[model samples]
Target: MAAVAILLLVWQGVSVAGLVPRYMLPAPVEVLQAFWKDRGALWNNSLITLQEAGLGLVCGVSLGFLFALVMDASPLLYRAFYPILVITQTIPTVAIAPLLVLWFGYEMTPKVILIVLVTFFPVTVGLLDGFRSVDRDAVGLLRSMGASKKQIFWYLKAPSALPQFFSGLRIAAAYSVVGAVISEWLGGFGGLGVYMTRVKSAFAFEKMFAVIFLISAVSLLLMALVNGLERLAMPYRKVKQEEREDSQ
Candidate 1:
């Protein structure tokens, strides 16, 4: 917060002192005023983007989870598919967006697809790593105790994967909004990106800044929600932290 305050103060000083033109880099207060003025429009557009992001995120996570399960279940399948996954990510999203728009016709489907493509890799990789990282000795012990594969998975693998899954989820949460905005830029009836395009065309730089800040806020909010979910999903983390504090 202090760092952000300092950066804002410097930005204000530069803008107010005419070191940078206001049109090129508006003062923070001017951006705030723009945001306030367009609050209603911004809210409406934001909801549209949020809906796209949320749907993409849910679908992307589910898809990645299923892929992770399949790959973890079969080493041959992992070998066959892992390279394909990495190859898909190698294609730049911007390059793909226009094609998606062309095929899907400027609707929400392309945007959702773009976001899923952007967000799923981290989740798939994180979960694969976690599932592979489980202790061999522990697995052997569980097997010695006559544990079923399902029992070993639930008791060991699933719990082990939660940390990495949430780590990937945090990244995915941020990426989801960004993906939605980028896809919106290609073509969309409504969204922060569409609003930005309009304001930019009209030379409303302050409003542009306002929308930029709003996109960032939305991304942060998504990440915070993911963090909250992580806490709920792993209450044992809190218990461990409390025990460490008590020992200290």
Candidate 2:
């Protein structure tokens, strides 16, 4: 709330001072009005983008987790694939967007694929690090007790990795929305990206700002959802009442 208030104050100040042309950078009031006027269209486009982002996030994270597990189970596979994964990140999404459009055309497939590409790397790396960074002492103790590898991984490594995995998930959730929008910008039938393009072409600065605000809101909401899931999945990580009292 404080941050938002500060931004609004600055925006209003700039508008009143006439620092930029009204058409170039519309006042917050104008943007709010534009948002209200186009509420239904904005909502429809936003829903399309959200659906693509959600699907991509689910697919990316699931595949990433499975890949991480495979890598954890096999040193050779890790050595063979880790560098390729790193190289994939070097190729900018903007460059890939056009090519994806060419390959998949202007449809949800390309956007979803782009989202998956953008989201998967962080998740894979985070999970792999979390799994590899598991307490060796704990592993040794489990081994001494003749615990199977599956048992050790299930009880120790997987649990230990949850916090880190969710950290990556939060990042991926934010990126997924951006990735979908970017892909849609390159080529798409319906989405905020396409709406943004239309608004820009028509020189509707207020509507552009409105769409941007909506996109930011969507990203923040997804991040918050991921944080909630993290808390739910790792309840044991929460500070116990006794621990809180002792710390105090």
Candidate 3:
């Protein structure tokens, strides 16, 4: 709320001062009005983008976790693939977006694929690091008890890795929306990216700002949801000594 208030004050000041032309940068009130006027269309397009982003996030995270698990289980696989994964991220997505569009056409499939590509690397690296960073002594103890590899991974490695997995999840959630938008910008039927292109073409600066605001809101909501899930998944982690003392 404080940030919004500050932004509104700056926006209103800029509008009153006529620093730049109104068409170039509309006032917050004007953007809000435009948002209301285009609410139905904006909502529909946003929903489409959300679906693509959500599905892509799911696919990317699932694949990344599985790959991380495989790499964690096999040192040879990690040695073979880690550098390749690093190299993949070195190529700019902007450079690849056009090619993706060219190959996949302006369909949801391309957008979802782009989102998956963008989101996967962070998750894989994060989870891999988490898995590897597990306490060696704990694994040794488990092994002494005749715990199999699968049992050790399930009972020890995975639990220890949750924090890092959630860290990567937060990063991936932010990227997912951005990936969807960028892919849509290259080519898409409906989404904030397409809506932005249309508004820019029409010189509707206020509407564009409104769409931008909506995109930020969506990203923020996603991050908050991930945080909530993290808390739910690791409730015991939050029960610190202070909490124990208070309960006693």
**Alpha carbon lDDT of each predicted model:** 0.95, 0.92, 0.91
Best candidate, lDDT-wise? 1
Q: Which segments of candidate 2 are over 4 A away from where they belong?
A: 240-248
- Candidate 3: Cα lDDT at 177: 94
Sort by TM-score, best first: 1, 2, 3
Root-mean-square deviation of each candidate, in angstroms? 1.1, 1.6, 2.2
lDDT of 3 by residue, 32-78 (tens): 99999999999999998899899999999998988898898889999
Clashing residue pairs found in predicted model 1: none
Encode model 1's per-residue lDDT on 126-166: one tens digit a residue.
99999999999999999999999999999999999999999
Output the lDDT of residue 159, model 1.
93
Model 3 deviation from the true structure expressed as Cα RMSD, one decimal place? 2.2
Q: Name the best candidate (by TM-score).
A: 1
Q: Relative to the unseen true structure, what is the C-alpha lDDT of residue 95 in candidate 1, on a scale of 0 to 100?
A: 95
Ranking by lDDT: 1, 2, 3
Worst 10 residues of 1 by lDDT: 114-123
Candidate 3, after superposition: displacement of residue 106 in Å? 1.5
